[model samples]
Target: MPHARTAPALSLPIQDARERLRVLIRDLAVVRGRVVLSSGAEADHYVDLRRITLHHEAAPLVGRVMLDLLQREGLVPGIEAVGGLTLGADPVATSILHASAADPALASLNAFVVRKANKAHGLQRRIEGPEVAGRRVVAVEDTSTTGGSVLTACEALSQAGADIAAVAVIVHRADASRAAVEAAGHRYLAAYDISELEI
Candidate 1:
């Protein structure tokens, strides 16, 4: 009889990762005052996750934590690609790709970006990088408010023929993004909700 195969278990301590992320977010990403989101929604507080995702100290932490979350939560089974809207999802996706490349147990995953719209020239592609056709993917974002950015990215990915496995983000600012994502029939993961932050 053939034995059943299983995924390699995740062993990292998520609480430690959370503490590190919490400090990094508090010190570098959290800002007070009103700002308009990419969704055109106004907010009294802003979590500029790029502040951490782009950092030397925090970027790796974000990647490790996110990958850990995916693995621990059993969200990694079918995902072959990771990415979302250009700027926000860029670093997070890169981090996961790099980390996966170094880890033996994790599947080698490709990263991709979704343009807000198709380019006018060249390939005129809406989703750029490796081909996503027929692959399972997870849409990543630096922060979320209305979830509009992640949803748009996923829509493009789906149109490009990728099956969305889940949505991941550095911070969840409100309920809308989560609701919107789940309502679309995909699982969602957030490293930290706004309530977890000091600001």
Candidate 2:
């Protein structure tokens, strides 16, 4: 029998992924008019992440890029599970799960979704995962401004006794997030930064 071909490792330039993501944002996602940011700053354009996450083509591409980033940052070797705050982390986490599932070498990493709060009844558990305790985890997000959301998710994971390996996002808006993640002693990775978007 012919030797089975090894699956090729996926890779992409950080800049190229940013440009492609912008194209997807412009073509598929709607851009709201200029609006003030929570930081009291004026902005010319708005990026609705849902546009990319919900798009048929863009969503999968996002998954690939995110998985690629994890590999690029060297966190893939340490991560046992991937997840973050719900709604935003939902798609990315699912994508990571899919990529891992398709590759036997990567299949060891499981995916989970973190709830903003615990369930009202039954388990009343704050986390739902396949025994993430003591496991290394990387929290995924669509965007990060002040890192509050990511921090909250990290707190939850810490409470559950999971070591937060890193925080990876589709976009990193400011330096504050980088500082916070690093200050917390976790690796931080992003597919794009605000300046890279050329906005």
Candidate 3:
């Protein structure tokens, strides 16, 4: 008979995972050049976090680091799901969901997606994957400059009867984002900032 194969452990110490993710972001994601942002602001450089968020190695680290951030901040307990706007937040939310699966304590965590707009036909829903109604969920993003994307998701979530636990991100590039999220009455958390990436 063939022997059964065992998978390797998926969890890591929070600090180690966080440090590794920081290095990966600096090396793989940060692009140095003048460019206009979605927020309509020009900057000397841009941090394109999707590169790391979807990377094989960095994706696991993203899950661990983001989960740890929410855990330490005391937002994970009552939270039933995690997600934000589609595209950017999809992988981030999925990463966290996968990471949570490795830990029984976080096993209840699930993921959802907020569409840019409600589908015109069929279900006509804006939020997808596991109903968020009446549940507490954390909004996630790869990165944010003005907090607009996460906030948009939060609005949809609110309309769906979900309680916004907080907003979390992989990288926080601007102070304005923090202010914007807080102004909208949601706690803001980030695993890393641009300065921590040594950029």
Could you estimate the TM-score for every candidate? Answer: 0.88, 0.82, 0.93
- When sorted by TM-score, best at the front, the candidate numbers are 3, 1, 2
- After superposition, the stretches of candidate 2 with alpha carbons farther than 4 Å from their true spots are 1-19, 29-32, 36-42
TM-score of predicted model 3?
A: 0.93
Per-residue lDDT over 1-199 for candidate 2, one digit per residue giving the tens place of the 0 to 100 score: 9755422323445456545666765565536589775456676776667778866556666776787788888887678889898887878887777767655676467888789999999988777877779898898888777787887888889999998888998877778888988888778898877665555
**lDDT score, candidate 1:** 0.84
Counted clashes in each candidate structure:
0, 0, 0
Candidate 2 backbone collisions, by pair = none
| Colliding pairs, model 3 | none
- Which of the predicted structures, 2 or 3, would earn the higher TM-score when compared with the native? 3
Candidate 1, run of 10 with poorest lDDT: 3-12
What root-mean-square deviation over C-alphas does model 2 reach? 6.5
Worst 10 residues of 2 by lDDT: 5-14
- In model 2, what is the error at residue 131, expressed in angstroms? 2.2
Candidate 2, residue 58: Cα displacement in angstroms equals 1.5
